[model samples]
Target: MLGDRLGEITGSVTYQRVLRDDDGMKLETSFQATGTFLGVSVSDVGTYVTVLRPDGTQYSEGRGIMTTEDGRTATWTGHGLGRSDHAGAASHRGSLCYQTMPDEWARLADVLVLFEYGVGADGATTSEYWEWK
Candidate 1:
């Protein structure tokens, strides 16, 4: 993740697949962030563990899988937390679709985009776009 000095945030992320069972797949990710935001040395840390099915459906925090009319597509109920300057907890909920790409290249492209957008520079945004060769 990378941001501006006004809130400059930059970091590297590492993800590990920890468990795969009949229930689903579990991913553990760690992020190291360091930067300046709000005139303060912004240093934060956190981790996320997501359980997703082979079809890309996630099950956690009241989110689950829902099928479309044709049954060819699956959608997930989404939820997350918001970062705040004050110490508190925030929550979010939304819906997302599951898509299957044709090849590994496509899959990799999608992952790269996600990382970039997740950590791209945006005022008040904690994440910024990342690119890899």
Candidate 2:
């Protein structure tokens, strides 16, 4: 079961590039966002690589770091599958695992998170996370 929503972030795609084309069309993208996570203010930055499969689906893996307003940090990695509309919009669902600095927020290390990620044609991005129960 999915639990309460843990966080949400709105950001912009900072960069994107074609990485390869031989087997499948692979691309790398990076983004930046600011939002509240685990009830604390944070800034996030991440990069992900995606491959366009023959059936028009996409597979991606990404890793990122989030820093709290006071300097504490956490790291996360995730994988997801999605499809584009061929008109510059896409949506994905994935799982995320996090590791945090051993502090008050360390409980995050024991939690499994599920996420919904979306990108608009103009490069806007939104991500929402929920705890897995």
Which 10 residues in a row give candidate 1 its minimum summed lDDT?
A: 88-97
lDDT of 1 at 116: 18
The residue-by-residue lDDT of candidate 1 on 1-133, one tens digit each, is 4222223355555433476767666655455565543333445344555565555444332222222222322222223332212232212222222243223224223232212113322212244322222
Residue-level lDDT of model 2, residues 99-129, one tens digit each, is: 6553876666787889999999999999999
Query: Can you list the residue pairs that collide in candidate 2?
Result: none
Q: For this target, which candidate reaches the highest lDDT against the unseen true structure?
A: 2
TM-score, candidate number 2: 0.93
On TM-score, the leading prediction is: 2
